[model samples]
Target: MLIPKLLWPLLEYEISTSSVESIEAIINTFTRKWLGFPPCQRDVAMYCRKAKLRLPLISIVEEYKCRKARLMTMLEDSDETAVRLFQSHLTINRKWKVCKAVEQEKKALK
Candidate 1:
């Protein structure tokens, strides 16, 4: 309910409202505002499910892929710090990939 309202506006205003951080922030805010602190963390999956039921959006997944691509490019271009950063990023990408796969599976059932 609250998520769709806040999120749509952010997507409409930003050229690319796709980052995981951005999406997470919007979700956190929406859940907190509507449901308050108690059970906030527990409600995230339910909120995402509800969002899918209403206005479906896949920008966060796209952004994760784009970020992975960009980080790989960075890794190729540099040494030391950049390589370490890229490895850290790769771990994050693996998590996003799992989440994306789950989302796809859920969508397939619908």
Candidate 2:
């Protein structure tokens, strides 16, 4: 419910890590306000689904990472040469911010 409404078109383009981090800070602020928490409140209360009382807050960073990984996979497996070339980002070290993040996530999972 929340995802489609709040983040419907976020996957259309890749974003820089700084942009994602800024968005995350804004999201944390809004969630804190929405959940009636103090400015200094930790993020766990807003994001911990496993907690006894869960706040329906989503992390923008997590969401972006997920969408980024999906997009990367598609690009990697794409039949179009243009897309594969763009995904390589050769001049940019073949590693965009989200690509690095996805790689780190994969390592963490394993």
TM values, all candidates:
0.27, 0.70
Q: For candidate 2, lDDT tens digit of each residue in 10-99?
A: 566444646766777887787678768998788877788999987666787678667767777678789999998776552232334656
Off by over 4 Å in 1: 1-58, 79-89, 92-110
lDDT (0 to 1) per candidate: 0.49, 0.69
TM-score, candidate 2, is 0.70
What digit string (tens of lDDT, one per residue) describes model 1 on residues 1-110?
54446444533332232355666667556655674556535434543645544324333435445554454455656768746554433434333453354446558989
Kindly report which residue pairs in candidate 2 clash with one another: none
lDDT for 80 in candidate 2 is 93
- Model 2: residues >4 Å from true position, as ranges? 1-10, 89-96, 101-110
